[model samples]
Target: MENNTWSDDQPIVSIQNVHKSFGALEVLKGVSLDVMKGEVICIIGPSGSGKSTLIRCINALNDIQAGSIKVEGLEVHDSKLDQLELRKRVGMVFQQYNLFPHKTALENVMMAPIKVLKQPKDEVEKRARALIEKVRLQGKEDAYPGELSGGQQQRVAIARSLAMNPDVMLFDEVTAALDPETVKEVLVTIKDLAEEGMTCILVTHEMGFAREIADHIYFTDRGVIVEHGPPDTFFDNASDPRTREFLSQIL
Candidate 1:
């Protein structure tokens, strides 16, 4: 970082010595990481190991008290940064799916681009249709969230995020609420996105899926990253005993 050569090819996300607290409890303690363009980073650990908090902080869902998080060269921790625009660049899909319950699938996908970005309705619809198809929900656009299965609804949520044309996508336990059979469909769509070289940060418990598509894996614990490396190395021979224990319970 000191060489400054990376300035020409700045990282898509740069988190430096980030720390966050809630009242009396410290959640993130001096955590730091960098994500290069198109990199797929899978964050995994025990339930309370700060996995979800870290990803949420990336897009500013929870503000950090110390250190800095920069996305596409803008410091997120800075008060001057445009949070609304930042979210446009860094999209997030949560475990709850957060789709509009009343709106049909296509409308949920089309609403943001039209209302937030102020794009032409015709143009937004064109792209929304393509995104719906991309998520393998081609024929379900007319269905409401209540009519679709959990997996289908989540896919629509994913498509809604993609409609924003984000530079990076964050997945927070995306398949956690789905039935076992429903999980595969959502995973397949995410795998396709990874293959297409979209910069992604996934906080998930699906060990097999994470091992398959992640370019690098970060194992965090006690508000710090304890281990990080390529899938083969870290999964096979993690540097820490705590990482081994966590993987054993889930894997």
Candidate 2:
């Protein structure tokens, strides 16, 4: 199952003993993980368990107070590191669809590449249109954000991220805010991306989806990783009592 596009020896995203705090509330406590190229790693845990905070650290969305994170060998927290370069390599889709309300779906997908990357409009538009179809939203290209359903807007958000040509995609509870009926559509889009050999890190409450898609599953608790393993072992034979307890409640 090796992907020829990326190597397996060196990790693409690395985190070591990371600690993050928001004022007096300490979030991530000595969290550490490594994401290999073309791997889908799912982070599952109770709310406020630092799952979201940890992924945010990988792309420098949240600053770490201690330890280090590196993406493609560049230090994420380095003061001299180029933020735009980091973002271009790592794309993130949030729980909320943050599309510009005034822009059409195609315009939203095309905005960043055209404005930030200075790509030619025609080229960006072409890719944007293709991405729109990739996410199964071909006919809605001209629809405004306000006109689309939550799931459609989220699929558009995924396409917008894809327009940047990111090497790694981070999904932070992307389906959490959608209606029950619409959640499956967003999950299917993500599953398709993972199958296409995208390196993905997901913070999710969807245990079934995690078990189905993840090469490895990480369970976090109390701001630290309680247990991590392949879905088969993690779900049926978790070593940590906390992991078992959490799974019992959820699964």
lDDT tens digits by residue: candidate 1, 1-251: 22224342788999999999888889899999999999999999888889899999999999999999988877787787777768888999999999999899999999999999999999999999999999999999899999999999999999999999999999999999999999999999999999998999999999899999999999999899999999999999887999999888877
Q: What is the lDDT of residue 231 in candidate 1?
A: 96
lDDT of 1 at 49: 85
**Candidate 2 — which residues are off by over 4 angstroms?**
1-8
Candidate 2 all-Cα RMSD: 3.5
lDDT of 1: 0.92
- The prediction achieving the highest lDDT against the true structure is 2
lDDT of each: 0.92, 0.93
Q: State the weakest 10-residue window (summed lDDT) of model 2.
A: 1-10
TM-scores of the candidates are: 0.96, 0.96
C-alpha RMSD by candidate, in order = 2.8, 3.5
